[model samples]
Target chain A: MTSTPMTARRIRNGLKIPLMLAPALGLVVVLFGGGILVGLGQSLGYFPAIGLNEFTFSNYTTVLTDRNFLISLWLTFRIAAVTTVLSSVLAIAFTLVLREKFAGSKITTFLFQVPLPVPHLVAASGIILLITQSGLIARIATAVGLMDTPADFPALVFDKGGVAIILTFLWKEVPFVGLVILAILQSVGPQYEEQARTLGANARQRFRHVLLPLIMPGVMSTSIIIFAFTFANYEIPLLLGVRFPSTLPVVAFREYQDPDLALRPQAMAISIVLAVVAILLLIAYRRLARSAVK
Target chain B: MTAVSLRHISRRFGDHVAVRDLNLDIESGEMVAFLGPSGCGKTTTLRMITGLIEPSSGDILFDGESVLSTPTERRGAVMVFQKHLLFPTMNVAQNVGFGLKMARVSREETAERVKEILELVDLPGLEDRKAHELSGGQQQRVALARALIVRPKVLLLDEPLANLDANLRITMRHLIRSIQKEMGITAIFVTHDQEEAVMLADRVALMFDGVLQQVGAPDEFFRTPRTTGVARFFRNGNFLRGHRRGSTIHTDVGPIEIVSTSETVEDGPSVLTVRPEEVRLVNEETDQENVVPAVVTSLIYMGSHTQLTVTIGDTPWQIQAPAAFQARNGDTVRLLLPRGHVSIVADDDTATTGSAEATLAEGSAVL
Candidate 1:
């Protein structure tokens, strides 16, 4: 017990902050960071589990040159773009209503926040039950004489446009973004709006100049988070997208489960490309936000 | 510029009356100060003029036309608040030019006018600085420039200098008075500092307990007070309880001469008010109308003047004398209470005493 351990004492005294942070740092460095490194290695065609030991760029070359991959990329971009734009715009409108002092507004605000804790996969299943071709709405329409048969109902899920997937995301995400903007609106509440009204600004001008600019940081932050999450999510699109030209996540996940082991490196290559593109888009948005706030 | 008028204006919040039936006619191109203690309805009246707070029953007219139903933006009346609420996201130039931007003025003209206004407020070359980047005084100057840039017909200032330090408060008072006069803009300001009202306004309107007590020029408040409450508010603290017979007040301190006008009854129980500064310290009882022999009881040394409390018979009187005067406690002295400075007024015991105590309690808390 009297013998000194120099490195442990040094860590306790001199590197106190790093020692305390080791637990969180360990998970990030060992799990996600290590996983990314492994993916990067295998993405160059070095999958040791299947006994292929040579590293090559052939996997990336194969995926990048595929016409089907290009079609999938465009389709995924449109879905994420439409969902995020609609969620953000509708969220601001919802926040404006929530800020009013009408009857039952407090209960309504509480109800709006209820979807925040729900899982995205659960929301997709709910969408399937309600709006798909043979789902509740279609059966009700058939009964109501609006449709002659279940097949006569429009195909919302597993369709080329991916309407059901976007609807699912909107159902969950509008509240998420609305609650963020609502917090900002409540904190700085109407002080600048009152001043603007006295300065000859009409209702529309007050919202455009004062309220919108004041709450922009919150809106931009939530929208970017939603875009990144929806871009990389594989479950909803796989369950609700077309078989041909599926999104990048679903296509990569399909390759991951294939019986042929040679396709393992292709899955890793596609995932690495997806992560890099999401980061690049986020960087562009950060630049846009800086200029807009100024 | 516009002449503003409030006719029979009153506002009630539930059971609490904020501003009672008030009528005031403000001339065109004049500056007026709504002055009172806290909870005195001055600010409520000011906000009513701006149409931000509606009166329960009244007609507010601008340039002889009813503006009670007109929207705040269309009324051409802008308010400068105590907090100097510059938009946090905008730069100095953008904040100053906000009114012009709303009016759809050309960008070049807005920029040019913003620059001119910044110079007028003595804060030039600060166009790009954000609100947090400037000092408090500079931010307030920008607030003034923002309100002035639109050439609004009526300017409403709600305690605009109440948030500043003592020295800056004086500086801003002069700046506001000069700007209001030079631009020939009809302006109304609300403040609790009587000195500020007296210094910056063409006329002072004093309120108490949700009711307007008096409105006149600054000197009129001192010479011709309408009631005892007005006298005590301005700290004209020499009140002698007496019985009035014709023009003289008979009290324990002998007959105090007064120049009673039409404001008081000819023969009745009364109270007389004389300002402390009007009383004089003398070596002997010269031929003065209200000279009295008294013994000094207490004295407080205020720099320019010394307040001496003296007892005549069994009653005490507060009077101010020169700072260098030699006087001690229990010293016999001859005091001259001037005749022309005395006024007989209605007793303030009839006014709400409970509200008066509440006002004093709040004032002490603020101090």
Candidate 2:
């Protein structure tokens, strides 16, 4: 019974974070949370300014039941999954090579990190200029006599496969994953690898049993952020994806920008749905990541 | 069992020679200690045996075959590091069984061997604990078990007991020696402390400035050290400059009689020393063959013994006397330098002391 009242020191410890967070959290709550509240209110069909004062479930039902919703969801999921798997795998492989110093290793590490600071928009633009049918690679092929003309080059950009979108995301996110894991590898030092060598683990076995399990935690956590970003990011998919089956963010964004304001609730519903999916993904990734080493 | 040998092997890091002309043969199933001060190439020699660091010159042989071209994993010369570098992400059983798994042993066999080795190291039923969860001593046992599971041809230890506290270090030393003997595995341990070297090794190889100064049984080092450098390293402080004639060394003061336990030197100019612990105090009424008249200049009353500094014919000598003895500064006493404890060592870097003394003699002649 006496433990019910916290001691002064305990009370001080409890208030430490909130007191520290109070200053920066004020503007963030108003600008970020305020917008989410407005979006939620509208998604529930309670936009009084639009002459819809009654709270209802019609907007959610409409967004859920729409036939193209599934296609948009599939496109978003495919792009995010493919980009994440490829980039995470490539980052780990490249980081392993970088960790073992060789000729030109420093230069290779410097070039691998060159894409890290470039924004997603810039990456998307670069991929467009270099990979589109009449873009730089196509012209180079034509000039090199591999193709008769630039138009003869295969259709790469604006394809139904969403290759351009995945490429752009990979370009931006692979370096992020690599940088995080590389920093982790540096902190871990070289003695563990030397110890493994002395234990008679060959190169492949060392990587599989020792190095992989050690660096898995860093890779998995960074890859979660990569998945979320690639899933809901708007610009890369908007510029690279086809119009009919674009990622969910682009579709929701398109609906939000429509001149007819009644579609606002549908757009807000899609936004809420996207947030819910991201949360589910966060939970799913943590579960998988925790068991990966074992 | 593997008879590991290094033949004229040397390692250089850029221009600095880490190990120069290191030649040693470790017999199969025998344990040898590589003893040296820090930076004396002992660790470098151990790493070379594991093939972790390539020797810049010469060859390393296992069972009389050159293993210079073999990679570390295939060499079967496993090493236990000072930090006991167990894999951080692995549990105890996983870490211990990793080597067996690499050899493509079945899961059941690996498990059985891991269990056996863990019990041997006295950490039973700790299979599921993570590496970080173990205490420092427990981690070292896991490391030893991990190396032993593979049945390495030669086991190398690079100061593995260096990180432990005093009590734990003694326990680990006994555990290591028993395990090595039980497995009949050839082993080499590198350490800077002479006591540990003498305690653990069947034969101790002393190194100095990237060279093996001497190699012998621990007792032989105390009885018959080869050179002044070796004698000075063992703290043999009472060097008498004399001419050798049988067991007698005629110094400036008088002919001091000694009985060397190992070898008799050729009749020539000699420099001899005895262990400080072998020197004893006697009264004026006693007469002895090796007795030399001395005066106590200083004394320090350590708990176990009183350390006394005495001078005989202008040369200071250190002696460890019984702690309860009544001796004071300026007391004239007769000290006995016992037979079978004094050794005649060869002249090397410390022979310059004789030349410096000759210059003093020359100055006295000029005066």
Report fnat, model 1: 0.68
For candidate 2, the TM-score of chain A alone relative to the native chain A? 0.94
What's the lDDT for residue B359 in model 2? Answer: 64
Alpha-carbon TM-score of each model against the true structure: 0.89, 0.92
Model 1 bad stretches (over 4 Å): A1-23, A134-153, A239-245, B262-266, B281-288, B291-298, B309-318, B324-335, B353-367
Tens digits of lDDT, candidate 2, B19-78: 999899989999999998999999999999998899999899999999999999999999
lDDT tens readout by residue for model 1, B1-367: 9999999999999999999999999999988999999999998898888788899998999999999889988888998987898999899999999999999999999999999999989998999999999888898999999999999889999899988999998998899888888999999999999999999999999999789999999999888787888988888766666667788887666788877676547575667777788888777737766877888999888999888898777667788888877788999998777888888766676455767745643453343
Top candidate when judged by lDDT against the true structure: 2
Which residue segments of model 2 deviate by more than 4 Å? A1-9, A25-30, B243-248, B258-269, B284-289, B292-297, B311-316, B326-333, B347-367
